[model samples]
Target: MQMLQLSAEAYWGVIAHAQAAVPLEACGLLAAVQGKDLVSEFFPMRNAAESAQLYRLDDAEYLQVEQIADARKLRLVAVMHSHTHTTAYPSPTDVRDASAFDPFGALLYVIVSLKHVDPVLRCYRIVGGQISEVSVEVQW
Candidate 1:
């Protein structure tokens, strides 16, 4: 299986962002060294959809984050979002919206579900409308 190595700070950042979103789904970007699977940074963004069930990264925020990543010599490797009332799995909407969403081809998708007391995070790769689980390797 494919693996996504995430820094502990980045992991917590994602979780905190998700928790802050509360009723609405949270969303963010993961940055890594070009062509690498290691996530070195997390960039939290406002959920444009503003819905409890779904998330949409604001286009302006996305561009700003992209520029920040580029300046840091990192490339955006994945998109992370939270599911407030559902499991940490991609929804039909996610599958449909993810295809060709990244100009750099398919992107890793990290979903955090706050449906339970302990949040569950899952990784996936959605390419050509197919969803495949990816192993998440947390790095301290």
Candidate 2:
């Protein structure tokens, strides 16, 4: 499995928090140094799901991403979320939402599976709603 430069501590922290938000859904965005391969910032979003139907990031969240990129001198490299009862891979709804929503096709989609024994984190690039895996360097 591939890994992202995200700090293990931070990643696990977010995972635990996300998993705790179970049954509904959790969402967040990641800010990292442009091409540096390390996550430097994390922005969590509130789950606005109405019975398993998740809402896309609203305007405020989108604006916040731009601000973080500017302030941290990093690009909005990835968008992350947790899967409550499924695999780490994107679901049909996820793909559909990514196609119609994700602003930058350049950003990676990171999915964390809270249902497994050890949480599973997977990253992908969504192009026209087609997800392609992207590898990163991470340590155990």
Candidate 3:
């Protein structure tokens, strides 16, 4: 397993939104800060598709997230999306689509499980059409 260090506040915020989007998948972006080490910050993205079957980052929303990172002088660290009914693992489709969606390889895929009212989040790195578990630590 790999490890992702993130701010405590940001982690909770992501989980909150994930729960709120229950029954539907949630999506968001992560800003990576590089210092002595790497830390990521989560920024929520609106789920435009009420159906929750798909996710797309519009230019406006994308810009908003980018601006926030820019304001803090951070880099686009990762992209996150949730699965409503599936496990907190990447589906085959997810692996196939990851390449096009994230080319930088900095994108860490996060999946939230809606199997219960309280969702569970798991991180993964999709590479070469394979998904590998990534360890994550929520820093308080």
Candidate 4:
């Protein structure tokens, strides 16, 4: 299994964004320095779908975040979104969309579940319509 390393701050940032979004799904991007597996930056993005069950990153915002990552010599390591009422696992739509958008199988798909009393965060790799969980290691 693959491992995803994230800073404590970045981990909490994802939770906070999920909580703040409330009924709507929150979306963002995670970036890491090239050649490193540790995630160093989080870019919260606008959800173009603006729905509780669906999310789409705004194109303009996506480009902006990509440029920012490029400037920092970082690569987009993952795409993150919150599930207001679903489990942390990928939904069918997520699987379909990920396969289409990430055909190269380069990006991790992180899902934050707000359905339970405590929010749950999980990471996955979706390629060719197959989904596999990835372990997350929070670094101090």
Ranking by TM-score: 4, 1, 3, 2
Clashing pairs in 3: 2-135
TM-score of each: 0.94, 0.82, 0.84, 0.97
Worst 10 residues of 1 by lDDT: 98-107
Model 1: colliding residue pairs: none
Sort every candidate by lDDT, greatest first.
Answer: 4, 1, 3, 2
User: What is the per-residue lDDT of model 1 for residues 20-135, given as tens digits with 9 covering 90 to 100?
Assistant: 99999999999888877779899999999999988889999999998988888898878999999899999999988788575333579999999998999999998777788999
- For residues 39-102, write the lDDT of model 3, one tens digit per residue: 5577888776755655555568989889888888887766777777778888777777786776
**What tens digits encode model 2's per-residue C-alpha lDDT throughout 1-140?**
13457766557656875776677667878777776767866777766562333535656877876886788787776788888777878888888888777645767788887677788888888878677887754544
For model 4, state the Cα shift of residue 128 in Å.
0.4
Off by over 4 Å in 2: 1-3, 50-55
Tens-place lDDT digits, model 4, residues 1-140: 38999998889998999999989999999988899989978899888999999999999999999988999899999999999998999999999989888997999999999999899999999999988999999998
Error of 1 at 61 (Å): 0.7
lDDT of 3 at 140: 76
Better by lDDT, candidate 4 or 3: 4
**Cα RMSD (angstroms) for every candidate in the order listed:** 1.7, 2.8, 2.2, 1.0
For model 3, the superposed segments whose C-alpha errors exceed 4 Å read 36-40
